[model samples]
Target: MFRLVVFVASLAVATTTAAHFPWLYVADDSEPRLFFGEGLDHREYHLPDAVAGAEVWQEAIDAPALRLEMEPLEEEGFLGLAASQQIEPRGFLRTTIDYGNYHGSRLIYDAQHFPAENPEAWPEPVLAPEGLSATLRVEGDQLVVVILHSGAKPLTGAKVTLSNAEGGPGLSAATDDNGSTRFSRAAMIDGLNGLMVMHVDKRATGEISGKGYASTTRILTATFNYRSREAAKVSALQPLPQAVASFGAAVSEGQLYVYGGHIGQAHDHSRENLSGYFGRISLDGGGWESLPAGPPLQGLPLVAHEGQLYRVGGLDARNASGEEEDLHSVDQFARFDPGTGRWTDLQPLPGPRSSHNAAVLNGILYVVGGWALAGDSDGEWQAGAIAYDLCSTDAAWITLPEPPFKRRALAVSHVDGQLAVLCGMTEEAQLSKQVFFYNPASRSWSEGPDFPGSAFGGFGLSAWNLDGKLYAGGMEGVLYRLAEDRSEWEKVDEFQTKRFFHQLVPDGRGGLFAVAGASPTAGHTGSIERLDLVFAAPTARR
Candidate 1:
């Protein structure tokens, strides 16, 4: 009985000691938690005491007695603590560490335990301006400078000084409200020989701290050539030669061959009122020549098909008694062969019409939407559209599909194997900006985007396919390029001047030549202008 009592006393002491110990859990490199030795006192803890049993509950009671709540000894292998010391708490962590030696490994910490704070100050360096640019014009020896400040606010009250390579006396000026400065006698500076350099002083202050202030200097080159406004005005005042209207103009091999559009008094006394003449001008050479007068017609010649120019359906005779009769009751069609420089009669059109639009598609000439005379009165507008095949000279003119809208004086050009009709006058003689595209293959019409500005009236409309894109020029002196996807139209550039009744001929290079346009301001300019399309360069971003 005494021996049993001693054993029970020994087991009770052992249980009391185990109840005072606290459990320890260590995490492996993979963050898997593992059991370690329990401890009533931290110094008595041992790693090998780790086991899977109910001792975990006994250690929980001893946690406060061992002071296990103290921060782990982050050094040595104590409870799997790392050997490195705990990092000092910095204001904020930065990501600018050099990863070249470390092979891209990042230093990470438990963000929850170490919450970041607002930085007392930013350690990053401040950036400076890249470069300075200026545009200047010289009048005689004096220079006028125009500086562009692209900053958020205007740089007012800045000082600008000029110097040359030799560093001699240069002009100085204070910037005005608009950030512009001009020197009265910049030419008086002796050292400012060929190249002049201007210096700008910009003063900036810190907004937040009031402790930092910065002053930057920028240099600009002022080498420029200038002309006086008086000289430009004098050149503009020079008179231009007058242009006389003569007809038989043919566009041959991309050149305009012009013939007579003139009528003169008859030489015989009896036939004093009857006179007709014709002349031609080559757009390449800019000279006029005469063509034999065909039966008199009071109409303009139309050129269709690649090689043939036609004069079809015109009033034949004029009477001396102040009355005129349409003698050419039947349609008359004359074809001029540019290869041989001769005229031949072809099969006439089915109906007599005037002021019509003609377009050639797939080797067929389509005459569209014109006016026909009702009685002896003036001609009435007609909505009929006709087509003729040039391959069969004797083939009668056949009625093809008509336009969705009846319009006269409209300009039509072939675009992407389709005919695009531009702005023209309606039967009421009012201009319209309605644009339409007709597909000859599908025999369908689709509406296109309207013009940006007002409809161009009596203006030459032409389209050319360049680099797989279509460009059209109108009377407003604006050239528009069609988006390749046919979604929208963009205004590309403006012509040198506004003109009406002009002709646009593509140069076959990616440009266009404007010819024979009547300028309302200049009065029938015979001058030709060429437009070369330019594109903007792509910009680089930092």
Candidate 2:
């Protein structure tokens, strides 16, 4: 008699029989036939002599009886079912069979049909598939692969392998009890890093937050499979002309331009904050050179827009009107012409702000959260956002909605078509890991993924987009990579030291320019470094 037993949580029993692990298969035709025990589940479902019983049921919208009857089989290693009527287009089949010596060895299966048109139209799974899954992520020049089971349980002692996407030899890792294991990205192949979990344990299951991935209903399979086709690694590049920190830097005409800031030994703050120097570094290996100087400014927002380098507000403690003329902040605005070597003043900002971040798109510039000086109270960060369109003749600062939260010293860059704001200091003076993406077309702000490792930003906030990938590093001394297609940031490589206040510009030659910055012990380093691209290739193919 057909029966449905109550599911007791504590009595949950899993099966990963080394002898027979059943799998269901279907043809690639419009009207396909079903089969069992063929591909990876080779030894799982061997047909037994005098078969006990096999039954099939399909999810349906309109059916008299969803249960199915078996057709007489001439095939040796296949299971066939004859349904009475049409099945739902988005439907799947659930099967149970007894064909082994093990008592009560009933296997349940939920297999989805391919060629699904819409995700919303897909039917829910009748039974969950028990398998392995993993993700290969960039972690400090290493590719760490996190492994999990079908129920989001981490599998310890599981054997995993990585190979070229097309097919080749591979690398192996035995998972730890925490279900955590790592691989090196520098050893990964150029194409896709194809990963497969080789664990065969049935008693492994764990609780996981459902937010990370959608239900594996449509993509259900007996074995877990994943691919991180594109990965990144950071390496040392060229050093800077001199040790500079807390300065204004920008990239124009494939060159990096800098403004005044503190020039100290390493990451030391003892350096004088009074320099009116300006310089630029060429991509042709010409190195750094002095440019016409402007008003000594530091902690100012700079950007390259419409062939002109523009400067936003700044903090002016180094002014020479005696010490009394020093101001905590100023609402100054100007644009520099590299040709004439002069800056033309423009309308000042809506307010006095510094240590902020900005991005330019289509001749319009957007400046986000930053700290503002108060006459009496300590400077507090502001949530205000403003924009200006230089393309318009009567362009004026326009106020927009507040950003994700109040913060300052952030790395903001334009990626793919969105403005991504990352790193910063929170109100509590903690490293901020919140990521926000602003869509210009929709005029909307959405939350992105938090950085993989630690929070970063502050006076050290510096980042840029190059080679179709967003590269961010500083303060935290860890270089992060985020491609347009990825929602989360990956820890690609680590800097030589705990550096901050550095400038990052794409070299356009498959590398990046690491300008001067400050390190904890090094004080200030004029040592500019270049990070060439690195990748992991397959050691052997299996």
Q: Say which candidate scores most in lDDT.
A: 2
Provide the global lDDT of candidate 1 against the true structure: 0.42
Ten-residue stretch with the least lDDT total in model 2 = 1-10
- Find the candidate with the highest TM-score and give its number: 2
RMSD versus native structure for model 1: 33.6
lDDT of 2 by residue, 468-520 (tens): 67777787666777744556566665554456766777665776666656655
**If scored against the real structure, what TM-score would every candidate get?**
0.46, 0.52
Per-residue lDDT of model 1, residues 1-542, tens digit only: 00111111212233322222222222222121112222111323332222222111111110111112222343343442221222212111111111111111111100001000101111111111333333343333345454444332234565555433233344556667765666554343322121222223334222222333232222222221122321111111111122211122335565544322223211111112222444444434334455665664433335546766776554444344244443332277778776676788877878776545565667877666556653466566667667777778467788757777776655666677877777667877777777788887888788887645676533345455555566666567767777765656777766654555455555434566554344433333434455666552212110
| Model 1 lDDT at residue 401 | 74
Candidate 1 steric clashes: 13
